[model samples]
Target: MPYSDKIERRLHLAALVFLCLIPTFLLFARGAADVSLVLVGLLFLTRSTLRHDWAWARQIDIAVLLLALLMLVVVVAPFGEYPGKNLSRGLIWVRFVVFYAAISRWVLVDKLAIRVVCYATFAALMVGALDGVYQFITGYSLLGGQGMVANGNRLTGPLDRPNIGSYLSKLAFGVMALAFVAREQLGEKRPLAIGAGVMVPVLAVIFLSGERAASVLTLMGLVAVVIGLFISGGRARVLSIFLGAVGVAGIGLLLSSSDRIAGRVAALGAVVSDYADSIYGQLALMGWRFFTQNPLTGIGMGSFEKVCRAQQPPESLQFGCYPHPHNIYAEWLASSGLVGTVPWLAFVGIVIWAGLRLIRAGHTQTVLVALYLATLNASFFPFAATQSAFSNWPAILAWMSIGCAVAALNVFKRSCPTTA
Candidate 1:
């Protein structure tokens, strides 16, 4: 019966693995296209709940569920005029909570988990990278793809989009983790083959993703892993550092002349412009405006634009719409207000606490995963959580963090089996 349960579990998880990217893939889709991903995720959750073998929500996922409830409260709080948008935001909140939980608990829990996600990420990365390369060569996207690159050798996978960094971050972690597991299970044929098969594509895919930040992250992650290995008496310190440096440099060189990288760096100087400010700065101003107008409850979900227009400098209001604060903290305060802010902060505080605890326990891999997550959080701000709920970010990251923790804990188990 348990065997049957595990089989069923895998089946549902495999379905989730395939279905997870539907939202991102729907970028071409317009008008409530994002809602489709939400619906699909709900169905996935329903299936998971009805399964006999499945337990109640995984502990890590509870935070996301809480986020969903809080979003619902904010949406129905009667603060803003945009009921439709607020409700929709609430729906997205619930959906991401479910999506994150399903993936964390079912799809992305094991060694097979990383492989499956990697395959999907690799496909997308390859297509986008190759498309960019082709555009650079022939001067066009697959079919009239616009703004692939303006005036540099760099490439953009999808126009006006910059999410490949987060994907790359996860992939780098996945590949390194996979390599670790593969070598650990070296006597086993299956792990060996899977790891060997994935290593090349993973490298090629990250290269093509063309995310300079991600390239840096990948190097940083590998270096951390190496330092971890030697510290744990698991592998040679110099070997790890030497190899990590080589990999990071190689990726960085590939993207060095990329306009995407160059342009982003140039844009940094314009990040907080007062007059010629970027959209991000204006969004910040808008966020502050919304918070000021509705300090207690906020202007409701998705009301950033409405509230912004009402208060933004009329000249700026004449420019265009504003959706979200590019900064997650600013956005959350505007939508969720102080009431919702407490839980969000608490959740982050807990994650930091857990990570610190892991390090203190001398769980080398935990420290590695934690450090990666910390540095990544600094750079990306919420790890895909803005679009997702609080639960979703950790859900995705938990796989690597938990896997590393478990593996490291195994090392410190009651009896480190002596080679009798």
Candidate 2:
């Protein structure tokens, strides 16, 4: 092989390794994941430049550029409380843009790279789920017991909290996408077995973690999958039956073992009744207050903790001020205000619109991409509690998925030129 060809091959291999490790790194060492992503992104950019290949730039939609510009405005607007912190976070956003561009380029150029990523994600989920189960049975995970509950009642797995469920839910979407792709590539029997095998453990872990948002989103994703299968035709009956069985079994297992799940469901009404008194409710109120007070520019990025302390009521003080409103939309409005939020909303809207269009087009690969994007949007729906959108893990995952979907759409257009 030519020297340039060999170099390109090595670069692709390195990219694949880093891509595969993203979920594992996010699970164990988030900081490391960010660093690795940065390196991979730079390498991709270098390769593209050296080869004089810039077509991938066209794959990037206007919404992403507008979002980036909006973030830059937030960084320089002098509205945030902690300029340095906001600047740091802003740099991370730029990193994600670079990461997205790089990943999209890779997906567009390499037919099988995205499949490898899906497989890697599935493997990571299985390992993480098993670790959570182990933690439940023993008093410790393979990593140790720092975050694991000793009673084996509530499984935190490897993380310091039950937040693992949210991450697991995100990965479950990837697994579902993989199963969809596998059904086309590897035939019906194998995909059915793969889907069931991967999903059951994932649902079990989500239930064991007892995170209300994660569990709800996961169930909703399952429902969406069944609907998609029904709409797409071809053995819909068998797939629906299989999915129904898995759903029933998963719910039954949770209801039998997890009092936390039952308790959360039972308390939902009471929690809603006394909305202003709850920690989440109070934080959300604070977010709305910030947005209303500074509708144009808001309090500023990374300023929520400081502002929350000053703005929160005396009763809310007992629950404590949080770094960001535990809600994605509220955090955007509170920190960046209307100026930052409009573009953010547009970005999400475009992604959803594009995903729906792809699903309507009826290609298996594009449909999987659409499903993944749909699941992601549902996971971070505005009314639900969520991690900070500007936070490292959430930001990385969100942008990465967007980039992948965009790239997949590009590939779909190329393969079916009529679609373009």
Top lDDT hit? 2
lDDT of 2 by residue, 2-90 (tens): 88778777887887788778878877888888887887787787778778976756543544654645564554346676677666656
lDDT of 2 at 132: 81
Error of 1 at 203 (Å): 7.6
Model 1 has an lDDT value of 0.49
Candidate 2 stretches with Cα past 4 Å from truth are 1-6, 53-66, 69-76, 146-153, 182-196, 272-274, 312-318, 362-370, 401-410
Per-residue lDDT tens digits for candidate 1, residues 175-284, read 34433443343222353355435545444534444444454455555556556655664445565666668776765785585655555545544442442355555656
Task: Report every candidate's CA lDDT.
Answer: 0.49, 0.68
Query: What TM-score would each prediction reach against the true structure?
Result: 0.69, 0.86
Off by over 4 Å in 1: 1-17, 20-40, 47-55, 58-64, 74-76, 110-114, 136-138, 142-147, 150-154, 158-167, 170-236, 247-264, 269-279, 317-321, 363-420
Residue 103 displacement in candidate 1 (angstroms): 1.5
By summed lDDT, the worst window of 10 consecutive residues in model 1 runs over 411-420
lDDT of 2: 0.68
